[model samples]
Target: MFVWHGRLYVVRQVLNSWSERVPWWRSTVQPDPPVGAVPERGDHRVWRVEASPGRALGTATYDLACVPPPPLAGHLRPTWTLIRVAD
Candidate 1:
């Protein structure tokens, strides 16, 4: 789930999702990996999704990347960052 312009949106479909080799702490953004992609020592996972703004209105595509929790923070659930949006 995510909020945009005061509207909460929910993912309706996963258009694509993959894991990559880059560390989540790095500021660099790599190009998306192929579908069903796998990486050695992968550290980042991104998901491209179609979401609706909570009311069955038009949908938008959202690219979200998982921000892994700190080491030993197993009690903490991972969070996601909103990377892109398109109608």
Candidate 2:
């Protein structure tokens, strides 16, 4: 999720395909007592994305990834290569 004006905004595509990965260190050995949190290994995150198809000209669908987070209250930019239209 990207923070804009301190508000969180998630990508549509990623939200649609939202996922998460838990830590594996805990499973490999004893849990760390310092942190005191049983690491649920392989626990994936859930995404709640909101995408606007055809928000712009020549844009049909926008593929959201984990790189280059959304701008903070500046502008909602879409990845040129990742943006696509459903066939």
Predicted model with the maximum TM-score: 1
Compose the digit string of candidate 1's lDDT tens values, residues 1-87.
Answer: 788778799888989998766556453465555764332224668899999987659888998988676676667667667877787
Q: Each model's TM-score?
A: 0.65, 0.23
1-87: candidate 2 lDDT, tens digit per residue: 454345443444543655445346655786443553222335443433454433452322344333222345245333222322342
Q: How many residue pairs collide in each prediction? A: 0, 4
Please report the TM-score between candidate 2 and the true structure: 0.23
Q: What is the lDDT of residue 1 in candidate 2?
A: 40
- Clash pairs, model 1 backbone: none
lDDT of 2 at 32: 46
The top-ranked prediction according to lDDT is 1
Off by over 4 Å in 1: 21-42
Clash pairs, candidate 2, are: 15-49, 20-44, 20-45, 61-84
lDDT of 2 at 43: 40
lDDT of 1 at 13: 91
